[model samples]
Target: MSPAEQAGTQPELTYEQARDELLTVVQRLESGGVPLDESLRLWERGEELAAACQRWLDGARARVEAARRARTPDEAD
Candidate 1:
């Protein structure tokens, strides 16, 4: 399957899953065994995975912040 199709199939991967895949991509690129063209493709996929992971983390942070605010006593009380 195409990289984009594979990425879409894994919609909503947890932060850890996305991170692990990104790390693997980095390792592959660093190994230098791949052709330049394929390496570029991997780099692109890595970028997409990194963005997905960041989005997951951002959402989690927002939720945590919301929860914390909900529990805090009102200063105006």
Candidate 2:
């Protein structure tokens, strides 16, 4: 488990925050100088950040869909 999960306090990262961190992780991994252990750690962190970004996107999509439904006229009169 990750430190945040173990601590039971996942940080509330905004989509942008997660995306930025993920980008950094990818860059570090691509640079090809990190030790194997550190590379693995960065990969794990990248996965977590990707999941966080996905959650944010999913939430935004849901909200947009809901708003669209609300604005549409109900045909079942």
Candidate 3:
């Protein structure tokens, strides 16, 4: 079994890694040389990577918002 499977969680990908891989997937799909089956698989993987990137961005945004709310009015100036 994979380490993540053993750990009972999927491996965590950094936002940059997911975004870079999503770019590669997009490039491959755009290049138009892959077979239909491979293209479909790549498209699915792209979706997964995009979701991961979005989750990372959303978490970061939430943290920033929380920090802003926590700051005193004087600190905001």
Candidate 4:
């Protein structure tokens, strides 16, 4: 694997990392100087990164909801 894949672009990234890279992707897209093929690739990458971020968020939300449900009734007192 490439160094980037082995390190930065690995099998997973944390929510913050994914979101930061997505922000950079958006900026590159908005700057509007890339060739068509590279732009398409960047757009697709942005979509993937966005999806990864959503997965992290959804997992966090589910955990929070589960914890809330697990709380003892007396805890609300």
Candidate 5:
């Protein structure tokens, strides 16, 4: 299946799943066995997966920060 098709099949993958797939894409690109054209295609897919993973991380960080702020006790003299 094409990269776009494969990616569309997993629109809501967890962070770990996206990360692992991104890593695999990177390794395939770096292995130097794929043709230049194929490598470029993989690179593009890797970029998309990385972006998805980053979005997940950013959202999680925001949630954690919000939770921390909610629990922090106010300082008093």
Candidate 6:
């Protein structure tokens, strides 16, 4: 299944939603109680979530840069 489908019963999440869940994943990993396999799984998920967050941030940055460029010509006058 796609990442949007989630691995199991979990629902699809937006960038912000994935980020929130990633914080939980980080907290669990830091607490150090889960099994090895589970820890690895969380780590993998965290990587994906981090990538997703980066994509969102990159897209936002691109939009802002475009907006600035669009305004630059006007500002020059």
lDDT of 5 by residue, 1-77 (tens): 33334456555667788899999998898788899999989999898888778777777888899999789875661
Candidate 2 lDDT trough over 10 residues, lowest sum? 1-10
Q: In model 2, where do residues sit more than 4 Å from their true spots? A: 1-9
Q: For candidate 2, give the lDDT of residue 74.
A: 85
Best by TM-score: 2
Residue 24 in model 3: shift from native, Å?
Answer: 0.3
Q: Who wins the lDDT comparison?
A: 2
Q: Write the residue-wise lDDT of candidate 4 on 1-77 in tens digits.
A: 32234345657777888899999999999999999999999999999899878777777788898898788465656
Pitting candidate 2 against candidate 4, the one with the higher TM-score is 2
Whichever of 2 and 5 has more TM-score, that candidate is 2
Give Cα-based local distance difference scores for all models: 0.81, 0.84, 0.82, 0.82, 0.79, 0.80
How big is the positional error of residue 76 in model 4, measured in Å on the Cα after superposition? 16
> lDDT tens string, model 1, 1-77?
33334456555666787899999999999988899999999999998898887777767788899999999998998
Scored by Cα lDDT, where does model 3 land?
Answer: 0.82
Better of 3 and 5 by TM-score: 3
Alpha-carbon shift of residue 67 in model 6 (angstroms): 0.5
- Backbone clashes in candidate 3 total 0
Q: What would the per-residue lDDT of candidate 6 be over residues 9-63, giving only the tens digit for each residue?
A: 3554677898999999999999998999999999999997887677667767888
